[model samples]
Structures are given as C-alpha cells and as structure tokens.
Target: MTKLQPYEKRPYRPGVGMLLVNDGDLVFVGRRIDQRAEAWQMPQGGIDEGEDARTAAMRELEEEIGTAKAEIVAESRDWIYYDLPPDIADKVWKGQYRGQKQKWFLLRFRGQDSDIRLDTKHQEFDAWRWVPLDQVPALIVPFKQVLYRKVVQEFAPLLARA
Candidate 1:
C-alpha cells in the first residue's frame, strides 16, 4: 500500500494561517507590500517542507510578527479555507490548488505588544495594528472578508473564553 499526496497530481498545494487572538482581540492586522491600501489580513504564510500545520502556524507568527510561539495563549482546533481571487491568483500564486485552507488560532498575547516588528528580512507586511475582533472583517481585503467572517464565527467560542 502507498500513500497519495493531493497536490502531487496538481501544480500547487493549499497553505494555512493562524489568526492569533489575545483576550478576545485579534493580533496585528497587516497591510501587504504590493497593494498597500487594498490589502489587510492576519499574519499568514506558506507551509514549509515537512512542517506540520501547527509548526507552520507558529513559524509564520514569529516571522511575520516577530513574536515567538511561546507568546500565544490560545488556538482554534479546526481550519477555515478560502479560494484566491481569479484576478491576481495567476499573477501571484499561479496554481490550481483552489486557495488557502487556514487553521485560525486564537492566541492570547503572553508577551508585550511592543514585540511586534513588521520588517524582518523580506518584509512581508508594511504596516500593522491591533484591532477589535469585530473589526477584522471590514479591515481585511474585500475578497478575503468572507473567510474572515468564517474564521471569526467558527472561533467565536474562544473569544468568549478569553
């Protein structure tokens, strides 16, 4: 018997993101570099080789926000997915992998807010800010708003526990 890989038949694979929260408030929302005014999203990135979803989540959190995984206080158990907008999908990702299937995590900030730094090496985000949980949908890119809503709704219980 042999195991089959989904994307082995395709050109790309779906990635995940962690929507970290702290005391019911989401972490720093970012403005992407290419489309500064048009893009706003939770910290996220691609899953690496041999990396588990949780490991990718933790790595992305630190790489994007400069905060270590030890700083997170909570995370969601399930995942939320959203497809890419056809307009820029080919230009950016160039794939038939559908889109990102993110595992939204509700992290409680265990470290100081000052730990956030947008510029690492490559500069994934240009600017960021801590916003209220209710504001995430309106602040994210319009196409991604639907996923934001889903992620929030699915993780609503975690907020109540904060």
Candidate 2:
C-alpha cells in the first residue's frame, strides 16, 4: 500500500502551452472565462494520457481558441515550470498537482483573425486579441507572469523571423 504525498510535495502536472503568433508578429491571448479580473493567457492545457506534448499543444489550441491553423516554428529548449499559489493549489486539478511543468510551442498563425472561434463546446476564453510578445507577461495572472516572460524570452528570436 503506497501513500500519497502532500499536495505541496506532489509532482507538477504535465502540460502544453502555445504561443500563437500572427504574421505581424503579435501573439494571441484570450481573457479567461473562469476569472472575473482581467486575466488573459495563451492557449494551454494538460497533456492527456499517452499523448505527446506537441499533440497536446495542438489539441489545446483548437479546444481553447477553436483554431489549429498554425504551424510550429520552434519548441522550448527545456520545460518551464510555475507553482500555483497556495490558496488555489488544492482547489485546482483536484488537489493532485502543486503546479505545472509545461512544454511550450511557438506556432505561427496561418489563418485570418476571423478564423478564431471562442464558442467551442467547452469554452475556455470569453474574448481574444493579438498583442506584442513583450505585453504577454502583463496580461496573464500574476502567478503566471514569470512563466509568460520566460516563454516570451525563449521564443522572441524565432518570433522575430516568423
């Protein structure tokens, strides 16, 4: 009989995040449907059992933003991690994970803005917009600001040539 670790000692949830960039070099962000404050984020979600991170990223992008019309430009050299605030750690992910370890993909958008649909069967966002890469860190929740900044920094060069 194995015992479970405390949530604080639990492993981070494995996840995938997408940095969808337009031809103009702006990144896509969406206002969270679950948050009341002005919190926005790039498309991201958990990796399903047996699914690879790249597949999960594309699936999450379509599920969250209703479009997968993007091509991968680059992948982060290493996984990035962030911890959930103590107050919310036990509330999210059924108290199983303390945070997320994410593989981020830089994808170039291949469709027009009109192609982005938010009214998916399971909607994650209420509104969406394109913003410069540097503005991403400020648009997300405070807890995720550092993660966003790291993502931006990692992908900035690829985004410039994209």
Candidate 3:
C-alpha cells in the first residue's frame, strides 16, 4: 500500500455549485449573508448522503435562492477542488474537512428576475445580482478566486453561445 500524503489525509466535503445564467449570459452571484466584506458567490451547498450532485445543485438553488426554474446546460468534466484558508478551515464543517471538491453545473435561468428570492427559509444570501462572467473572480473571497476562475474558464465557451 502507498503512504497517504498529509493533505490527502483530510477528506474534502462533497458539494455542488451552480452557475445560473440569464438570457443575457450574465451569471448569478449573491452577497453572502454571513460575510461582512464584499464577498459574493454563486449558489453552492454541501451534498447530503445518497444525493447525486445534480440533485444537490437543484436543491441548493431552491434552498439558497428559493427557485428551481432553471435547466442544466452543462456540468464540469471533473470535480473542482478548493481549500479553505487555514483560519476558517477548522471553523467550518466542524473541522472535518479542509475544503470542498465540487461538481459545478452551468444552468440557464428560465425564470424572470422576480422569481429569484433571497429570503428562503435557510437564507444564505442577503442580496444578489446578475453579473458578467469575467467579473466573478474579483467579486468572490480571495481564497475562492482561483476556483472561480477555473469554473469561468471551463464554461466560457458554452456561456458565449448562451
């Protein structure tokens, strides 16, 4: 048997993130209710046991934005991973995970702006807006910038056709 690297010892949380795009090709981003800084992110959440990534993505959208009026356009070919900053790693997930390995879905929003709601029962975001894809990296927290960039790159072609 091969030895496990230190980083490999800590499990990554399984999660899903949605890149919901309007007819204008602008992506949806939300201002995190828990964050005081200018931190904004796409809808994302942990996948529960026995839940498929796509189902989890839909559930997260309903849970976070209070709507499921979107259809999947494409899914990331591979899982994208991000490590939380050390300061917050131990604080999140009850210290069980170092970060997340997420399957991202690109979705086309079929609903109007009024269909988007931020006051879900579990409200994760306080405010939200549709933004150009390029601006996404700069809008998110520093630790997640790289992951956001990769997601943007992976979906740019499909987004261009949107």
Candidate 4:
C-alpha cells in the first residue's frame, strides 16, 4: 500500500490560474521571463484580499496574459496546491510563502488573436503560444507537474467540447 503524502506545513499564497482555450481546444501558455532559466506556464497571479476566486481568476487572466476576452466556463471544485522547489522557495515571496494554493479556471477565449497582447503595463511573459492540453505538464517546472496533470484531467471533457 502506498502511504499518503502529508501536506506541507508551510503557508501557500492565494492565487488564481487560468486555462484559456480557443476553438481548437488548445491552451494558452507563456514563457516566463522572471525565471532564472526557461519555463512555460499558464497565466496565474495572486488574489487580492476579499476578492472571490472567480473574480480573481478573471483579473489574473488579464493582468498576466494581457486579455480578459474570455468567459469562465468552469472552476476547480477545491483549491489545488503546489510547493516551490526548495532552491527558490525562500526567494519568491519574500520568505512568506512556500508556493501557491490556486483556484484554477477554464476560460473560453472570445476575442481574436490580435486581441491577445503580451506587452501589458506589467509584463509577465516574454512570449506566448497555444499548446495541446496534454503537453502542459511536461512544459512546466518539475514541482508543478502533478498539479498540471490534475488540471488537465479535471478539464479534459470541457476542453473536448470547445
């Protein structure tokens, strides 16, 4: 029998993440510039105090990816958590957060390709592209792979219908 892994005792930052899809069911991902090395991830950001998860999801989608031209189609039933790899954990959130406890959302893009912009007032990604949902897990950092896989599994049906 496998032993259940215990949840880390560290605090997780409250954040919202987006799984934005186009008609072909491809998901939006971006190459993060703030990382010390190469990394690709979906749009995500911190949720402000008192903001509901859905509102934070929309706000994060636009703030990080440069567009709010999407509608929330589904939300994760529970908060999903990911811990930062030890090397950078103390540096990322000023030692206050170990990683993020995210509310993931599946958002359907309702605007043209031209409507997507990366050069927002506060840029998060250096480049962006649409990728098959299954490939997302492999593209992100190792620590977040499990979370990404769960996200793909959670939204696979909705992804197919788009």
Candidate 5:
C-alpha cells in the first residue's frame, strides 16, 4: 500500500460556494458574523473529504443557512480562487490558508423566503437576504470580489430564465 504523505500547506483552500436563486431571479446572501459595515456574501463553506463538489455545495448551503431546498441549475467548469488580503490572511483560519479555491454552483431555491434560518449549530452569518444577482460582488468582502464577479457572469444566464 502507498503510504500517506504529510499534509502540505497550499496557497488556496478547497471549498464551495452556493448561488441560490429564487423564481424572481433574486440571489441568496448573508452578512458574515465576523464583519460589520458591508460584508454580505452568499452561503459557502469548505468541502469535506470524500465529498463531491455538487454535494459539498448543497451541504454547505444547509450548514451555513439552514436550508437545502435548492436544485443545481449550473456549475462553473473551472475552480474559482480568491486571495486573502494581508490584513485578513493574518487572522482567518489560524493563518493556515492563503485563500480559497472554490467550485461554485447555481442552485434554484425551491422554498419560501421564510424557510431560511441563520441560527444554525455553528452560525456563520448574522442575517440573510435575496438580492439582485448583479449586486452580489459589491456586497461581498473585497477578497472575494473577483470570484463573485466571475460567478455572476457565468450564472447570470440561469437567472435570466427565471
């Protein structure tokens, strides 16, 4: 049997992001608990070992936002990445990660707005909302601006259909 290798530090952490859009074309977003001012972002989290990206995305959506009433509509073929600025990199994830490499998905939200609950076992956000997809990049933290921009561009077509 091949021996397991020691974990090596990488510049990007493996993760997934969810773009849950409703029938009205509004996208789900939340204000991060760790930030004040303007740090709203879509639900996202790390992918677990042995988990596929699509499953991970749905799991993360439920884990972060307390709902799983969504269906995958589109997925980005490439892994999108975001580099943490020094100020944030210095404090987040014990400084072990430089940033995140994410597989983003466009999911159609099937539940009513009242179904969302942020008081999860491990709460990541203070509040949540369904906003216009184009407004996402601006609401997200600056580090993820590029990732959100590309995500919107790629998934915007799905929204147009709704």
Candidate 6:
C-alpha cells in the first residue's frame, strides 16, 4: 500500500478551488495556461496568512475565473490532499505547509459562461468549457486523477439528484 505523505501541521497553506456543476448534460472545467507545463489544474492557490478557507475559495474563484458570489451548494466534508512533485515541492513550499489539504467546494454556476475571465487580472485558467464530468478523470494530470476520481464518486449522488 502506498503511504500518504505526511502533511505539515499548520494554520493554513495557500490553496485554490475548482467549482463544478451539472448543467443537465455537461460539467464546467477549465484548462490552465500552458498545456506543455503541468499547470493545467483546477483553480487553486495558497491561502493568505489571515485568510479563511471559504473566503479564500471565493477570492480565488473571482481572481482565477472572474467568478464572484457563487453559491457553494455543496462541499466535501473532508479535505483532499496531494503531494508536490519532487522537482518543485521543495521550492514551492519554502518552509511552509508541506502539501495542500484542499477543501473541495462544489458550486452551482449562477451566471452565464461568458463571465469567466482569462486575463491579466487572474490568469489561472486560460480557457474554460463544459464537458462530461465522467471524462474529467482522463483529462486531468495523472497524479490528480486519483483524487478526482474520489471527488467524483463522493459527489456522484448529488449530481444524480440534480
């Protein structure tokens, strides 16, 4: 069995979020800036020294996707975590939290697709689209695919009920 990486016991590690939805037939997803780099990830970032998780989630959503005031209809009771790739982990953390322990929030899009922004203000996602949620597992980076599977499985019932 693969042992999970030990997390640093801290107040907060800066992080971001991915807000997904069930629009009858599709799920909203975004692509990162460079396909060549592993930068293509769900909106996420580090938490400010005094930032709360929920507030930070909202701030990041706006900064990264130009989304503001989204209703967090659902969220995971637990925080899903992943280890940093050895190449960048040491430099990324720089004596902070060893890894991110993310609280995944599933939000319902309250506005139109045009609201998403990929510009100088927040260039987290260069592009966005709605795709079959089932296919997300295949599109994301391999390391994150495992956590994505679990998130989808846990939230499957919610989508079905919608």
Any idea what lDDT model 6 has?
Answer: 0.67
Model 2 TM-score, 2 decimals? 0.95
Residue 26, candidate 2: Cα error in Å is 0.3
Q: Show pairs that collide, candidate 4.
A: none
Candidate 2 lDDT score at position 60:
94
Q: Residue-wise lDDT of candidate 5 within 17-79, one digit each (tens)?
A: 988988888888999898767689998889888899999998888888888999998888899
**TM-score preference between candidates 2 and 4, better one:** 2
Candidate 2 per-residue C-alpha lDDT over 1-162 given as tens digits, one digit per residue, 9 for 90 to 100: 344458678899999999999999998999999997989999999999999999999999999988899999899999999999876887887777889999999999999899999999999999999999899999999999999999999899887787
In angstroms, give how far residue 51 of model 2 lies from its true place.
Answer: 0.4
**What TM-score does model 5 achieve against the real structure?**
0.90
For residues 27-128, write the lDDT of model 4, one tens digit per residue: 999999888878999999899999999999888888887779999999998899998875577556665667899999999999888888889888989999
- lDDT of model 1, residue 72: 46
Candidate 1, clashing residue pairs? 21-107, 73-108
Q: How accurate is candidate 4 locally (lDDT)?
A: 0.87
Q: Report the CA-based lDDT of candidate 2 relative to the real structure.
A: 0.91
Per-model root-mean-square deviation over C-alphas? 5.3, 2.1, 4.0, 5.9, 4.7, 5.3
TM-score of each: 0.81, 0.95, 0.94, 0.91, 0.90, 0.79
- Which residue pairs overlap in candidate 6's backbone? 14-45, 14-46, 14-47, 15-45, 15-46, 15-47, 16-44, 16-45
- Work out candidate 6's RMSD over C-alphas: 5.3
Which 10 successive residues of model 3 have the least lDDT summed?
1-10
Model 1 residue 56 lDDT score: 80
Positional deviation of residue 159's Cα in model 3 after best superposition, in angstroms: 1.3
- How far residue 86's Cα lies from its native spot in candidate 5, in Å, is 2.3
* Regions of candidate 3 where Cα sits further than 4 Å from its true position: 1-8
lDDT of all predictions: 0.69, 0.91, 0.92, 0.87, 0.85, 0.67
User: On lDDT, who's better, 1 or 6?
Assistant: 1
Q: Point out the higher-scoring one by TM-score: 3 or 5.
A: 3
